[model samples]
Target: MLTLCLAVSAHAASPDEPLFNLPLEGVHAFYPGDDPAFASVAFDDGDWPTLLVPGKWSESGVSVSTYVGWYRIRFVAPDDLPAGKLALELGLISWGDETYFNGELIGGEGFFSRTSPQLRSYAPSIYRAYPIPVGLLKPGQENVIAVRVGRHFNEGGFVGGPVQITDREPALERAEQNRNQAAAVQWVLFGIDIAALIFIGAAYFGGVRGALFWSFCAMWATHFAFIFTNSQLTYELGLQSLMVSWVGILLLGVSLYLFYDFYTRALGWGRFFPMTVLATLCALIPPIVFVVRWADWPHSLSFALDLAFQATTTSTMLWSFFCAVVAWRGGVRHAWPLAMSGLVLVVAWMAVALFASTDAVLQWGGIGVEVGAKLILLGAGVSLGIHFLDQSKRLARARESVLSAQTEERGRIARDIHDNAGQSLAAINLKLQSLQAKQARGDTVDAGDLEDALSFASVASRDLRDMSHDLAPAMTADEPLEVLLRDHAQRLGEITGTQIDVVSDGPPELGPQAKDHVYRIIQEALRNAVSHGNADRIEIVLSRQGGGLKVSIQDNGSGFDEDAAMQSDGFGLTSIRERTDLVSGRVTIEAKSGEGSVVEVFVPVG
Candidate 1:
């Protein structure tokens, strides 16, 4: 049985060890070769696969291009070993890794460019194992260990220690703690991704540049979901392991494409679209290579793919930078959040990519990968939060604008009534008082003159009532708008001495604004007909046609030219046109000399 015990000091291979002294040709020789005493696995290699010990691939004569491959090492536990826990320590895997001890699955880790190292630390919950349990071993025999490693572009892997055996509980505890921490980090990443989706969805639904934002967000969510599932933080739906691992990278490419679209539109970088398309296409290259024959591709090709990945990431960063600069230059206050959030994301991604490429720090059970992923995720969260806040502010501004407009409209109505209708009413009251005084003093008064005065007074009263109704209509509840039209026509006939007829055929129920605007437009049209057109008979028709409301007002009187009327500097036509425009409606005027005019307005309510 393999027994693991704690040593007072860190375990190191003896300098005299034969494996260390072997004049291993090339970097591969230094690595535990297929020989059981050293290493026993040979992964499919293409394009210069590196054979390096637990250190920087660069030092092992392996360029960054030679990062992905299968690694195997062989070791034999002594037959006399105590039956207890045993442990194997690895430094860090670049993007992600899977390890098997003596054909028994040990653990795996995966990384995300958008997530932070801290978040990555907690990601893999299921794949993490405390220590290579002695129970997993066939006692005192040769054991084969294999590792399948994948990396991001420009990042190469396996930068720490090789296989080591120990029974130390402290070491085992530390390993377990790391695995637990990684699992936690993964959960956090998942949470942040979920939050991003919700925020973007809300932004889109709220009419805040939703299409572009949601497209980018959807792609990101898909990519992260693949990473989470593949990394064993969550259960994977059935698929080959290699396919599962590479799927996220493929998704990342797609996300970057959408992100480019969003960023370009946001920043007004129209010229970048071609480049964005190119980058998206370039992203497909790696997946294609992997699909064609993942085993046959040299490490260099994989490295090149990693470089492309980095390039894509860098392009996204550049796009973000451009947006920040544009916003800053434009003096848009809201741009700062986007700029800062983007900066954080870029910086976080760079830090992880750099850490993954170097062994400046010790790797004890995939801690580095965890740290990098967490940092990226934290940055993503910050960026997403900023986006949400900006959207909220924009909505607030739009609502305020609407409210301000409404307030100004009410004020204008008040002033119009105060200046015109109010003064007229006061004059009528004075005339009435004078007539009453004359009658009370027994002064001679003509009955006809008194009747004329009373008629004038009645006209003033009717005008005042019409003005009041115009300011605040009695029907606040939704009713068929035809009711309001009929009421208006009746009032117009009583006041103008002109025969007014309102005809309706299947009029649709209108929203408040639509109803209000139509009423005001008709009121204005009637006023113009009486004061300007000198028309005796007016016909108002309200009907629905082609999913819209059509209002027509025709007058039988001597008509003026349309151009002359428009140049007369009157508010009636202008006001009607403006109201119709507010609801994206259209207006047409048909009039000529000696013929009555027809004003046709089509208002879309939907």
Candidate 2:
């Protein structure tokens, strides 16, 4: 018969109490690879090696981090211990664990049978307390507590944080408290990452939709995803273990790909062979490690391959650090923040890696390390925000400078044309008229010919004067746009031999810029009707609606397919559209074959 004893930490059972409380002293183990059949309570494991309860196999000199193991402990309940629904607290199993009372399954963290399968694993380190029914405990009789452990990920086996059987309420409260505390770290990092994501969205909406900003944002996002796969966190949140584990694995590969891509973008391609070659080697490391791991080679090959993978992984990581440093020194403004944060996280991870054999260190410090990994993303956020803001400011300043220079140049050109070109044309016209009069003095030319010559000169002079005036249209301060429109419409009607009806209603309270765009829009529409549609009559309507101005020009003549006209290089309509867009207005043109056209524009007025 196997006997085990466990002392109670909460409250030791008194002599008068019923022997319902079982204090586990130690367990008799039939370790994995020993006997798979010894899991039953009826199996004799008295001769097996003894292991302490409330501790992992690593405490018993188990060198291998991952394996399957079974632990069985038997204890006698106090005679006076109450027989009711007791609780069995088995805290924080790393991967998977199942509890059995007297060889019947009570519950499990992660369990899979041949017929049933679990899709994903959950949050890594959640506290668990299984309820034990009164029928399962025997007062003054030997009772067994057996646990099967499956170690698949990260510093494997049952974490052995806490073990006890106590009142149901306390057990539940303890479990809730553990979960809340464990979740705190995840929540902190989650907040930072989510906020950063929102900031990226804000920038996009604010007219900063550059693909480069979002490209690195994706990498930063994926970098923080690795923290979610911790088994306790998964359990706390009731996530699927298999799916979480798979995502965790896939994130590693995606991380590698993004790592390669980040450097590729930073260094650019084919520019420097040494840089590209190094990055290429870094990119190749993941696939090579995958091949080595998947091939399942011989022991020596596996050992050597594992070593090679470790070396390559470490080197690539170091190379990433080096690149960040190089970028920082090369005057990449955002590089230092990223490098500093990344280096801190790297050191934390390295410390964890160095002591992976020490289970206690991993259990105590691993969560902090995971949090640190996510915290580094804040550096990315700050860097991106500063960079985008600075870029926007620079662009704005550059635009203002360009606009100022363009205004100055336009003023100079207008003056030069009015002075030199207009004067020159006027002088030529007068000289031509004088020559025509002199040529006709002695009947050297026919009277009709002289008249035609003078007429051509007069037309040339008039056209030159119109061209000079058309170079730029200026409006005097406090002049309402309605008056300008009336003058322009009257002139156009006389020129086209078309009757243009100009109607204005309500006040014209538009900004100078908006009024300018509105006037140009109407002018273009009227010209297009006369020139393109060969319209004989144009109706121009201007009205103020709420805080905006609406203008419509309708003509009756040979109409056209509006789509074809808009798509084609029709200068009048194209200029109209451009002017409307300049004022952030909407313009619609409706026309069909053999039907007249209507062009309407809306410009907001201040």
Candidate 3:
């Protein structure tokens, strides 16, 4: 059990009453130097102005104009003091501080050098309890205590609760409990940031490398740094990196700008220039703010820079909401979810700012920040999932279409073979049987019968060859496209008894798939000219036109109406159009009744 004493009453404790409060009404302050004699009990600090203990120098009814300051407190100890190791509990000190009891050094934290005050500690709100030596206090007599504090920026001095002296064990235990309670929220937030990092890193490296995912990942990483830097654990562990928090703040603006950029693109709009300008301002402002505070400039300038930073950050959030509404109005999918998430973030942050003056809200362990991040995560995750699902559906539909086309083509080839070659072979088989019967019966066989049999055999061979050509020509990969086209034209001319001419003017450097599509388009066109248009002569030209491959097929046939040909249920022109589209090529057909017809195709080359 530890005896308690309060510093607010200024009363010395008696043995019968171990618990009493003492007020620090005699605390005095001096400015601008770190003289070693200031801590001595014999030094005269009575001429210095009185200052309020457990309060900031700015609020202590005194003007402090330098980075180093000192405070002295005089207290009387009871003659029958409690026999135990004691400690001086200074609730909190800003920046850095050191304390002395009865002209002797007790304990202190942070660098107190007046020449290099920038290297001082900055855990301004942490409870500090330093152990007091056993023989330091004089019974029934005045004891002097001195404190020196070094300020880097912002308010300085004892800025927490009242100071007191108590048993070392219980004082330290209470400090530990307070520190833990104050830092509990920061630990939880840090854990949330870690989990977010894992999930985003896994998603990015796992191939979800979209603009949204990467931007969100970067934003979360910056947020993590901000939270970690501000966390009490980082200070408790003595890991302070200068200007790291500012860097996080700077990157936050860039991340928000990137989100807006990606959002506008999703809505089919180009980059928004105002957002770009705002992001540039965000990147530029933080460094200025950091430098102003670091050099300990005028408080007015520092306040202005701080205000600018807040304004920019707040403007970014508001701009994001505006973009979301724009996207929603444009009918972009998942925009409403994102808007709702942003709404939650805006409301939470507003609450944080609104209740900043009250300890009740500040002590919630930053639930607002955590909840805002979680909501954004939910929105981004849902959006990504929906995008992936849509991509999968499109891919599946394309696969199904390709498979259906392949099946339809195979059936077309089977029917052609069965109808043309099958009948021709049957006629040839019957004619051979008749010739064999005549020879076996010893009857006079006529030359006409042999001639008829030979003709039927020729017809069957021609039909089989045409069917083979329709399936695919026997050509090597290295064969020139013009050679294939000319060969195909010659074969068609032999069957149709028409004059076919093929001319190549320029190189058509195309891939294998593109070449196949071109060949099919030409085949379809040639068949249409002969079978449908009853053409007698056909002319084909291959050339390069305007950085693309051009193929033109013309025939002096009794041409049919172009619109009617395209609209008819026949597969000739329809197949031509389909093949052209497959290769990302364009085709135009020109025809008139009793006039010549032309089919021209243009395909781009890499």
Residue-wise C-alpha lDDT for candidate 2, range 1-606, written one tens digit per residue = 001111231122122332234445345564653233555789887777666555555556654532456778777777786645678877666546677888777777654431122213442355667888767777789887777765432344556545767766666666666555555555665777788778878877887644346556767666666555644555545664444555664565465456545443432211245444544553454444334333423333434443444444455555666666787787767667667766876676666656654654544456656555554566556666666666566555545555544564466456645675556556667766676786778536556655765665676566556555444453443667777777777767775698888888865577776776677677667767787789998888888653467888899978888777756545256556556665545578888767889988876443
What is candidate 2's local distance difference test score? 0.60
Candidate with maximal TM-score: 2
Global lDDT scores for all candidate models: 0.56, 0.60, 0.66
TM-score of each: 0.49, 0.55, 0.55
Which candidate, 2 or 3, has the higher lDDT? 3
**Predicted candidate 1 versus true structure: per-residue lDDT over 1-606, tens digit per residue:** 001111211232122222211111124322311222222234323342446645454555544554344566555656666555555656445545556776666766653221211112222222222367657755577666666554444443565443455544544454555444444545655666677667666756766443335545655665565456445344333332455546754665665565555454343334355576565764576566555334545556655665566666666666666666686678544355556656666665666566545543223223334333334444444544565565465445545555644665667667766777666667767777887888999987778657866776776676677776767752474656777777767876776799988898887777787787788788878877777778999998988764568899999977778877775544256566666765556688888877978889987544
TM-score of decoy 3:
0.55
Q: Best lDDT goes to which candidate?
A: 3
Write one digit per residue (lDDT tens) for candidate 3, span 280-305.
67667766766665675664565566
Candidate 2 — which residues are off by over 4 angstroms?
A: 1-21, 34-38, 54-59, 111-124, 152-154, 220-244, 263-314, 357-361, 364-366, 403-606
